[model samples]
Target: MTKTLALIAAAVLALPLAATAQSSTDAKPAAKAAAKPAAKPAPKKKPQVTRRAAKAVEEVTPIDTSTDVTLNEADLAVAGRVHTGKIQCELGADVTVTADESKPGYFTVSTKGAKYRMHPVESRTGAIRLEDPRAGAMWLQLGNKSMLMNQKQGLRLADDCQAPAQVAMSAELKLNPPKSLFEGADAPTSGPVKK
Candidate 1:
């Protein structure tokens, strides 16, 4: 029984070495098999794209500026608050500010002395070209509202002029603001309301 056990141990130890030796021998054939010839690539067929006729692009004519830019009063919606001395009114105009919206027929309005580029209907744009020939008045469009500030006050109203307009911020004999943002138009009244 002792001899049998010793024989079994020796066989177990030798079995590992024998298995390793056999693997080494087997690896040679595997290595040779790995040295296989390169496979040939398949040929690709050519695309059958046919050429079509060129498109006929016509030149777009420029808008006629010779005449007045037709402004649609129905489209213009004034949405802003206008205050003068003790007078105030809410201008509910829906203006646009989206890019790529070419609002033709829209005229830039100038009231009192302020100016801003009037937007077209459905444009959703906000631009105040507050430079008009009208004196004693200021026009500005904030967001979607067109505000017209005047220099007139009633009995009950002290003043409703907007902030000292930048254009006339300086120049003492400046116009009296109806609702002066700094103070009442009378705060820096150079003289009586000229008109």
Candidate 2:
């Protein structure tokens, strides 16, 4: 009878411990579920900075820059025979524009155009050679710079003067007082070349 009672006591003690362990195990999963995060999707990323390789893909192809220009008769009547209306130094094929410290933000180049408005420099001496053909150059003191013109390759004032006389020369066909000033060339001849 004592052996059976001891056996019963052992079983009674083990039963509550086993039940407590089982209960804790079952409660742990619920607490763990609350502690842990739900399944999360991946985050989207922003665009990074563009590299040189990416810039290469974005870049346009290169192109040829040189062009040969021809002059028309109407282009001739312009002041000083220069392509630019403003009096600026135009660089020749051989010339280059360089930066200068004394005159910052401005450029210095040696070049010239085909024609010029000659402002004769008068002194005790007579007219010197304004058009220096040895250097194929002419000096034009134009806005904030001096123009050193090359006359060898293209047309110059000297070249234009040397044009065919019939096309180049200008003649004034003046009429006599007896004539009406408004009369046509076929009306009358009162002077030398016109007559």
Candidate 3:
């Protein structure tokens, strides 16, 4: 039994040596296969594409200045009332309004980097309103002040803008301080009151 056990141990140790020798021989064959150049693949036929002649494209007129807004007499009247030249506003900012000689009832409103072609728009409040529909900007001229607003941005670009006339009007309003609509409404009417 001891002799058998000794033989079994010897066979187990020899098994590892055999596996190492087999792996070395297998590696040499794999290395030789990698050293040999691989066969090149045949070129593939590409799909054919048909070419068409280019078609002439019509010139596209830009929509910014192309808008032909015909102003009525009322709108023109409002335009005439629009204060021209540079108007000072709050925060030391100024806006310039210039009437276009070529196009009546149209004015260019510019401040710093922005410039817009605006036209008078009728307002229910009796204020002179100029609008640039393309740029979504509006200039509102009131009795005592004017303002530039960006409708798209939902904020006023310039507020408390005053021209020469507006400055005087503003001072007058401060001095007189127009009476509110409800000032005398609460008081009894001059007519005989029913007891």
For lDDT, candidate 2 versus 3, the one ahead is: 3
**Residue-by-residue lDDT tens digits, candidate 1, 61-88:** 1112233334455434431222112223
lDDT of 1 at 13: 43
* Per-residue C-alpha lDDT of model 2 across residues 86-192, encoded as one tens digit per residue: 33222322233333345332223333343322211211111111233333444332212223334454333222111122122222111212233134234343567
TM-score (all chains, Cα) for each model: 0.18, 0.16, 0.60
Off by over 4 Å in 3: 1-66, 185-195
Taking the tens digit of each residue's C-alpha lDDT, what string does model 3 give over 52-149?
00000000101133357898998888898999999999999999999999999999999988898999876543567788878878787877778787
Model 2 residue-pair collision total: 0
Candidate 2: which stretches are off by over 4 Å? 32-195
**Is 1 or 3 the stronger prediction by TM-score?**
3
The lDDT values for all models are 0.32, 0.31, 0.70
Q: By the TM-score metric, which is better: model 2 or model 3?
A: 3
In angstroms, the error of model 3 at 132 is: 0.2
The prediction achieving the highest lDDT against the true structure is: 3
